[model samples]
Target: MIRILFFILIVLALGAGFAWLADRPGELSLIWQGQRIEMSLMVAATLLASLISAILIVVWLVRVVWLSPHSISRYFRARKRDRGYQALSTGLIAAGAGDSALARKMTARTHGLLSADQEPLIHLLEAQTALIEGKYDDARKKFELMADDPETRELGLRGLYLEAKRLGANEAARQYAERAADKAPHLPWATLAALDYRSQTGQWDEAIRLLDQSRAAHVIDRKEADRKKAVLLTARAAEKLESDPKGARDDAQAALKLSETLVPAGLIAAKALFREDNLRKAASILEKLWKHEPHPEVARVYVRARSGDSAIDRLKRANKLEALKPNNVVSLATVAESALEARELQLARAKAEAAARIQPSEGIFLLLADIEEADTGDDGRIRHWMNQALKSPRDPAWTADGVTAPEWLPVSPVSGKLDAFEWKMPVAQIAGPVEDGNVDMADEAIRSLPPVAIAHHRDEPVQKPVEKVVETPVKATAPVKVEEIVEQPAVKTIAVPVPTESVIVPETVKTETKPAPAKTEEPVVEPFFGRPPDDPGVRNDSAKPLEKTTFRLF
Candidate 1:
């Protein structure tokens, strides 16, 4: 619109100029190339305008002729570049699809058409394809060729690392991962691979260092870094345990401090302490741990540590523990055994009963048997405890201390109960004579037995009325009264001993009573419930046969 208006205005102005010039008879003159030229003003203006138009036309003709070839060439070059890019794109797709042969052909065509500087992506694609085909050697070559290209360097290193992993070259793989990590620490795959490599090689310290690097680089979250650090620290602790248990203990403790919920660290620390003969510390650790995790092994260790106490006493302590954790079978068993060991027979029995109520199993019966046997040595008492075991559900998890069943043979068939068929004494008789004449020897033998077995064994009486001292779980010394002396200004008196009313002396010196050789009776070993007689007639390898054995009664 502006161009049309300007053209109309120029035409009007020119008409007006011509009318004015024609009306005034105007003329102008100019000198050029030493020649004088004269003309009217309108004629001069027209002549100058005509000269400028001719010069513009000649310049237009020369420019059109001169620039046409270059323009045509540029259009063809652009088309060629576009076609090259198309080939590169197709090759990349094919490479991603694992069509190595097609990708390789397209890659070659792309390379032939595209400039080296423009086709780094194609090289990367070709390298990836080679890696897919398990051609690590070729892949490595391609990646190396493109290593200088900043855009592809990290990717190439990742591909190289993957190729190294495929070839089982862990060291080489680690090297590539490290390089990639240096170049692009935020790359998740590279960081993860590097972390894994460090872990697998037992480079915990290095792994931890790199994890910090990853965190600083914003490659992983803080929580994730802490978790990874924990895992590495645990592995390091395990490694340290073999060479330096104390160091291992520190590491395990550190790990636990970092995450209290970590069970492995606690367990490792406990085991390390136990190995160092720090049973007290181990028990403390276990008790603390039991509050969180009710593990059977932890219970076993805790019970073993409190060997001085009866199963009943242990049961009471365990009961207190149960206040923190209710109906915990492992804790219940620990306490039951402790109570029996402490000679708190009733408490042991109650705890065992509670355990049975919660979960009837061989363990509960075992606890019961421990309490009964601790107070009475009667074969009948032992058998009664065995009966309880037999009646209770068989727990395959229970093994008689060190006794192991045949590997190939199945465990006892008494499901959810003790192995009823295996008994050492008669179960039918609940109470009977607990001891024979040889009480001293029997006491010595009982003392020699393991704490658990002794706690469960029935107490036997000595023929000589031997006075046995029962120890309280906790001991207290009687307070002694001290006589205080004051200065001369105050009168102080010391307490005097009270005089006995009478004194008696025996005519003869008392001596230990000689025990008679009581009749040795064989205990009856019951198959399912009661103990049958030990078969003396049948020859056996070690222990007495079941039929002739006279059962001890408690």
Candidate 2:
């Protein structure tokens, strides 16, 4: 626009000058080379302007002709470069789409047209094509080539890491991930892989440092960073708790500052404080954790915070915990166990029953059995409760990846995941529900097994206990004393009706009378009950197996 306006201005100025010259005409006479030339001013001006314009035009034409070769060469080069880029783009798309043939074709075309130094995508396309074609060696070579280049180092490392994982080479994968993360902490995959490996190897300090790098690079959010840091600090605290109490306490306390409700952090902090003889601080921490989330470890540590304290004092502490978290199963169980330790059988039984009413589990039933043993010393009642416990649902424990741990762990042993352990029910058998009155699951379970011979000692007294025998669907803990299989002895045979399915339906299956194949000369094995486990003839495996052979008493 500016050029056009300037050109117009110049033209208008010349026209105005011409008009002025025409209005006030003058003569121009030049004496040169012994010759005299005369002309009007307007005509001389026109001829001079035309000669300068013609000279400029001739120069422009000569310059164009002189540079034609270079110009043509540059045009073709640019066109070839564009085609290479087009092929590179198409190859990348084809590789991602799993079109190995097109990807390979385009990769070759792009490689022919473009140098890998100038276009990094060419190597990437080739590597991807090799991977898609199941040529692992070629892909790995290409990835190595990429990794050697400074510009494509991260991409190459990612490819190498994936390939290592595919080949189940964890150490190689870890090295690649760590190398990539060290060079560029902002890369998400590299950072996460590096963190996981560091945690798995128990490199707590290094892991924390790497996590900080990730946080600083904004690869992880503030909330996630805080949580992960808390877990790491808690794990480190647990490691140092025994050897360096004060140091563990500091680390745990710091973790608590980040996540106040972390149970493991609070537990470690309290224990470490206790080890340091900071009873007041430890007790305070335990109370705070209990109020937030009731945990068994917290209760146990709090109840026995002072080693010098008597059982009654521990019971008092347990009472305080129960008061803080009213009606909770953990709190009630803690109180009951403490009371039992203090010899307060009544209180213990009452608390145990109350907890059972709230939520019956193996732990709760076992606590009840403990109370019974403490109170009456009755073998019958204790076994009854023990059987109930065995029949109860499984209790919750620290489980991760289908594996249970006796204590909390920072990472899963199975999957190497962070913060994986949880206090939840492990996968176990589901027992039958308990019945009211005289229907004891333990005795019933024993009776459900195959009949075992009960040989009596001379001094023993026997009594017949009537029971409707039925097979249990689940296996019993009762021991089946097996006699070695031998030659069949002559014995009477009785027809026993059994259902086609797992259940024994006496009324459904027709009972047919069959004649005895042999004479009743040999003694028959008759199933019996009504004797305590201490009976000389009854060799019971479970300490709590029901009367004699586990039959309900009539």
Best candidate according to TM-score: 2
Clashes of each: 69, 0
Candidate 2's error at 214, in angstroms?
2.7
Candidate 1 error regions (>4 Å): 1-68, 131-136, 147-150, 234-254, 267-293, 296-317, 333-554
89-135, model 2: which lDDT tens digit per residue? 99999999999999989988998888888988788898999999999
lDDT of each: 0.63, 0.79
Candidate 2 local accuracy as lDDT? Answer: 0.79
lDDT of 1 by residue, 10-126 (tens): 989988977887887865767999998888887776787789989999999999899999989999989988988998889888888989898888888888778867767877877
